[model samples]
Target chain A: MGPDGSRPEPPDNPPSSEDTQRNAGARGRPGAGHILPVNRADIPFLAALGVVASVYIVLIAGIVLAKVFYVQLPLVGEVFTNPGYRYAVVLSLVSCSITTILSVWIAVPTAYLMTRVEFPGKRIVDAMLDIPIVLPPLVIGLGLLMLFQTPPGAFVQQYVTFTYAIPGVILAQFMVACAFAVRTMMAAFAEINPRQEQVAVTLGCTRAQAFWMVVLPEARRGMIPAATIAWARAMGEFGPVLVFAGTTRMRTEVMPTTIFLELQVGNLGMAAAVAAVMLALSLIVLILMRLAGHGRMF
Target chain B: MIHFDNITIRLDGFALENINLHIPTGAYAVLMGRTGCGKTTILEAACGLRPIESGRIHLMGRDVTDMPPGRRNVGLVPQDGALFTTMTVEQQLGFALRVRHRPKGEIAARARELAEWLGIGHLLHRRPHGLSGGERQRVAIGRALAAHPDILCLDEPLSALDEETHGGMLDLLRHVHEDTGVTVLHITHNRREARALAQSLIIMRGGRFLEGETARGQLAREEDDA
Candidate 1:
């Protein structure tokens, strides 16, 4: 319509009434593509579902927090301050750190190879790596005990014992944690586009240079979360450490095994205290990851 | 200069048969074809991305047919821009310089100069995901040029850009041709694009070039059908 108070001429190809209504926002511009109109009735259904889910989640979380923060539990403070508990905590931290570092060092390269290369028996090797995840931890403990207990064990034990000791705990944790780490890293590697590496190659990067400069940077997003999960898994590992490396105070005992040993002796307060520490550590990891914008890194 | 002496390559369901191509020093040659017509396959073969079944590829008088991509001294700007998403645009441009151990001050200056030349001077600190499609393409071109490769292969450089940016990209391609005297092998499916930027044209179909001077005429027909 002109501003001179004259009626506008009809368009050369006049749009139908329905078409005009549908294109109200798209006039004189490129179409934003044909989108299905939102169904108005589904709004109420979606609102109701969101309300119910929120309430359910809040209720579950409240219950768990109430159990975890049992303020009235007697002797809890003493259990934490106890020298024995302090030793157990330090040992757990050290053992978990070692396990995590070793697993990451070995698994990252294996994951990269598994994702980026073609070789014989790759499928079988990949499937074999997952065996530790599915097999019960206690069974894995027993297997490790056997593997290191017989002729090979005897040969190695002459230099260093792998059964019923610190080495046994480490081996068990390594076996399980490395498998989990590799699985996590393999999935991460799979998500990265291979085109990035190819581009680097064309830009004069050698294979190793491309990996360090391009692929590894892109992988940091997923790798951070994978490492957090693996560290947590290693920290909380109990069955393997218990059976293979008998729960000995100030030696092979980790947090979970210590909790179990406390429970066997009817020390509920001490057991709960240890559980609370593990829970606190897990919460710390979660909070740090959230602060780092874990999900948005990609 | 880049030379392809009757090279052939076979993939899963397609084959490039006894193809011959030569891009003279400082020439801009475009390969035009429809979808699945092996235009990109030819570029990849030239870059040594795919193994050749026969014949040889020579870049700057050196036979690179059996060489790895890293050793071929060739650069590629793929359809997706293929920027390292985690690296800043400046680092992306400086990557080749760093690999070749160029002086730090020279690398930074050259990267900035190229980025400015491509009209992406302000985006040097940003990552690929932070840039628009046109910006990413410019950065990709800058990255390739920074490598100082003797030959560059661009696979469908403008196929993904919006129409509004298409003209500007052609201008940039022309500028790149003028600046470096870099031999370029550009692949496209658009006749108008080939006409605009290509100093020479090669038409391919069904993994083989249709023989004779009828190549351009056949492309016109394909465009009409399209």
Candidate 2:
């Protein structure tokens, strides 16, 4: 026996050649004789398939890029001279910021409850939150229109309006953006260990205090990416905002609606300018998300 | 005294049944068990993290079975240190005091004293992610004690430490228990550590505590049988 109290072993050596042949040959005998497909000879075929997939992806990207350049780029110059399109881009930014802020303010608590609490109807609440994500934007807009166009809607509108105004645009954007934010925040919260908050509770932190002090800090890394995604979703919201809030210049007009209006008027330059701005915003947000993850890797 | 009377917890596919123990004030008790044998579950029940189907927990002569974890007034050092990432070591140590709204100067003094006591004086400014595993546990311990809890519940606090680090950690913990005279309930599977630190030991298996005394003697008997 070794000094560590383990049993001694024979000298280490490879198994005999006959043993190897027996195992290999036995695999092809009777019930164990299964045909094996070796991929060593299919290297050329697999490489060709990979090449084909890449070509398809690249071709689609190229077409999108061409449309962007031909229709969107030249419009920036025209927008600089035209006050209408310039106002539209500014309005879009303002709407997106409002949407993002409201969504985060509400979704932070919603996400905390979803992650940390156990309630009877939690699953139903979670399912309800996801409705906006899958529902068509036009359908949502139509629903909103019907809801607010009635007597109750008119009664509420006397105090707070929701039809074809900045508030309407903000409301529409908030609905869609909050749904997206909740999903992102749910993912972020799931990545965090619940034990962190439990530790906080043991350290004399109240539920709110634990959330703010322990849970929020550890989740910040992932939550930042979530916020970026929410921002992109808010900025890219088109159909609901267009249908519900109408394309009004300097008031309710946003980048997407401006692009649409420009497209209808055959003003590709202005449309391209707005699309370029939207693309740049999305690109910056995406890069920020990627960089945030990259920073965590090392 | 920290008392658990006939405590039972039923959680999906697992249960802790009929646990009855009384750890007197200022005595260091250890819960010895294999991994996933309800060592942590007992601690969780005592601290109110788990709802006991039927039980009673008396801490400092008060029934705390229905109390929420935040109101338990007993400090817990979880398996992972669970230190706040956003706070520096000093801030984390003073978190309980901050929550209690203690004076800034008092909090500062307490944080420093605890840090020095835990041998983490030099790590006051470091974040938890940057500290070594042993260092983080020390910080966690310091943070737990800063509140001046009536009792301390540790769940395998030194299990993650390396061999060399474990000795120093045990020594530090021994000093802390002696100096403060706080009742300590530490849980671990390592008999050597249980012998070193616990004056009273409870052996557990499959969510039930085995009826026995003489921890070292029991371990020796098991060894002989094997």
Candidate 3:
């Protein structure tokens, strides 16, 4: 027995020669004999498959990088100086920023409830949140357009311009970003031990205090990535913005819509330049997300 | 003082029915039972964390059944410590006082005092995640008592510790009970632990409360040790 009263475990040792070569006659290793396709013989096969998958990924990445350089290098000076493109950049930044904030506000409580509360129709509510994620963005925009024409939607639209407005861009982005936000927050809350909050309450904290102090602080590891993802999704959102919020230059035109606008004008280089900008932004967000997740790895 | 008067808690299929139990002011009592015997339910109901169907809880002479958990002023340490992993030991020990907006100086002083008393003064700045199980439990206990709660209800505080740490923690708990005169209702499945520290014991069987001879003997043994 160890000093701690734990039963002694056998020392982990290398497998004996006989143990390794039991089916040795079939396998073709240093001392093995025969071949078993499902056994050690599949090692090379798995490696080959892994190599092929990496090849495909690297090939796609290489094409993307090449296109980015090909289009962005020539147009960089022009695109950055152009006021309309700059306006698109500003519009994209503003709308996506608002969408991220709203998504977080809505996601925290919704995700918390989904994980902690057991209510009737809970599964239905959970599945409904995933609709935007599962469905196409263009379909989402179409639904929004249709809904705004309805009496209730018309009332909201009359008070607040939605269909084909800057607000519509934000609303559309929020619509899609919200699903990713909720998914991230849900996973965060689900993984956290509920006992920590329970203990906080016992320590004289009200439920809200416990949640804000204990649960929220703990969920930061998930929240940062969620926010970054929401921002990235909002920045890259195309179909919804293109359909719901028409690509009006200097107004609702965002970075994504600029890509479509340039494409329609037969300026493929400009289109790729816009895509390159998006890729840069996404890369920055992804890197920040990775760094944030790594910082929290203690 | 803590009183559970005919407490009944009914979940989907299981029910803890007609439980009547009391621990006097400043008494160190242990509630022992087999697993799933609703021992934790009584503890929860007493703290106002879990709702009771038919009973009122009177703590320190006030009928606090309708009071919210924060207002009840009962300290609870769940099994496994359940320490706030995000906070340092010092912050954890002072969490309750800080939440109540106690004076900064007073909070620091009290946290330090409790840390010293718990023999975790040196570990005050360290987070619970980095602490050993024993240290975590001590920090949890410190946090619970930081508000100077009248009744400290500990749920298997020593259950997760090794033998050496368990003995030390038991002695520490006994010291707290003796020195500070805080009421403690510790729950456990171990009879030896019940006999070691409890001034009185309540043995629960299928949600029915029974007084324990082991507890009575422990009270005598503690008296003799003192």
Candidate 4:
């Protein structure tokens, strides 16, 4: 009721199917015998959008097919048989697994703080977090190299040699991969309603208990995509690893570096074989990511 | 009793300034106000969900201004119920008890009793996503009352319900107050709700409060003036 002593108008209901058909007929267009209620005038616009989208899809499919046809099966087998290639495969998988675990650990807390807490210089901190994502990959490697030459980094290096070591490879991958994971987890946390946690706190659970029992369960859906993206990013990382870890054969030689070394030696066949392997592994991760998007992954 | 001694809270660009309110023990007090009048803000401050810039909040004669929400012994049912979607109604009802590490048998019995009392016994096994608005609110109310807190604060609990459900919920709320004798601070903009449930009424405008008989006279005069 309004102050004017009249009842306020109720909200308008959506038009029913019959009303829609009547309006279409009033517009001199047939509404029946059509699967979708699309405007005839918009067909050209829709077709143009479809054409633009299909071009990118076709280009990607064509590139993958070209690689499949170009690589000889025997060369793929021989590449796998080589000790250096085998070592690269094992190292890439192990490092990416470790990197994914580390990325999730760092991302969950960072994203939670960014989403739930208010503090001075919050905007500055948010922008700083994105620096690794936006900066050139080579610059990140160069920055890490310079840092290790300093006091703090040198102190850590004394304990474990990271420059041109396996640890350097993991560190370089983590720097870039963690950024993507943090972005995904931030979005995940933002989508959740904060009231749930508040209710938990009021129900005799401490803030930490509410987070672990209430918030974390809901945020688990985001973990799969974050982990997969970090794993794929680490698997493909090359520039930072090349600059900081210095492609030492059978040492820091991940699959990406193996491809680089093969290409450097003019062994295009072996490089294509390794590229094909990485492509297959990436496709599996992509499929899992898509499943996660549909809420199919636990 | 819930007492706010010249409370002040600042958030974003909005501020609730120098507001004072007191609801006596075991009273069903309803706070009414227009949208953005800082009614919900006052409730959050009392529950210790938001920080107070200045002044004190006393719950049952204890100053809980600096206390954490979990230790404040408040039972808050936020808008739309905000039910935990991952848990069954039974688990939600028993959440507070489980957090306190109550015995499994005791928790189960209390949950069943609450479920039966709230007319949600059939919904015990169902998760929140499958429940209706009224059912969710019932689950939320039961969850809040699980640990038997000293005060219960509800922020527009019936705003999302249909007319029939709203009436049913009003009766349930009345029964709850009568049975438990818990101090309640219910927030609503609807005058009918206040008339039906509030033993004491507080009207807020522009972050200030008008309480008790004075608030009632002011509300009538404002309506007449408008």
The alpha-carbon deviation from the true structure for residue A24 of candidate 1, after best TM-score superposition, in angstroms, is 35
Worst 10 residues of 3 chain A by lDDT: A1-10
lDDT-better candidate, 2 vs 3: 3
lDDT of 1 by residue, A1-298 (tens): 1111112223442432223322432222344335455589888988889899899889989856865776335555655577777777877878887888888888889999999998999999989998999999999998888888688778998999878888888888888998988987887777676877888887777789999988887676556656776788888898888889988887888889888998899977777777777777777766675456344221
Candidate 4, residues B1-226: lDDT per residue as tens digits?
9999998899999888888888999999999999888889889998988899999999999999999999999899988788876789999999999999999999999999999998888778987764666777888999999999999999999887667677888988999999999999999987778889989999986666788898888767866776
Q: Compared with the true structure, what per-residue lDDT tens digits does model 3 show for residues A1-298? A: 2122222122332322222323321232243554344678788988999898899889999978787667757686666789999888878878888999999888999999999989999989988998999999999999999999999999998789998999999999999999999998888777677878887887778899999999998787677767987998999898988889888998889998888888898999888887787777777767776677655222
Q: What is the lDDT of residue A183 in candidate 3?
A: 92
Highest TM-score model number? 4
Candidate 4 error regions (>4 Å): A1-37, A288-298, B218-226
Query: Which DockQ value does candidate 2 get?
Result: 0.24
Models sorted by TM-score, best on top: 4, 1, 3, 2
Predicted model with the maximum lDDT:
4
Q: List ranges where model 1 is wrong by over 4 Å.
A: A1-40, A43-63, A69-74, A292-298
**In the order shown, what is each candidate's alpha-carbon RMSD?**
8.8, 10.1, 8.9, 7.4
Of the two candidates 1 and 3, the one with more favorable TM-score, higher being better, is: 1
TM for candidate 4 is 0.90
Model 2, stretches more than 4 Å misplaced? Answer: A1-68, A71-74, A284-298, B211-217
Per-model DockQ: 0.34, 0.24, 0.23, 0.34
TM-scores of the models, in the order given: 0.86, 0.84, 0.85, 0.90
The docking category that best describes candidate 3 is acceptable
lDDT of 4: 0.86
**lDDT accuracy of residue B83 in candidate 4:** 83
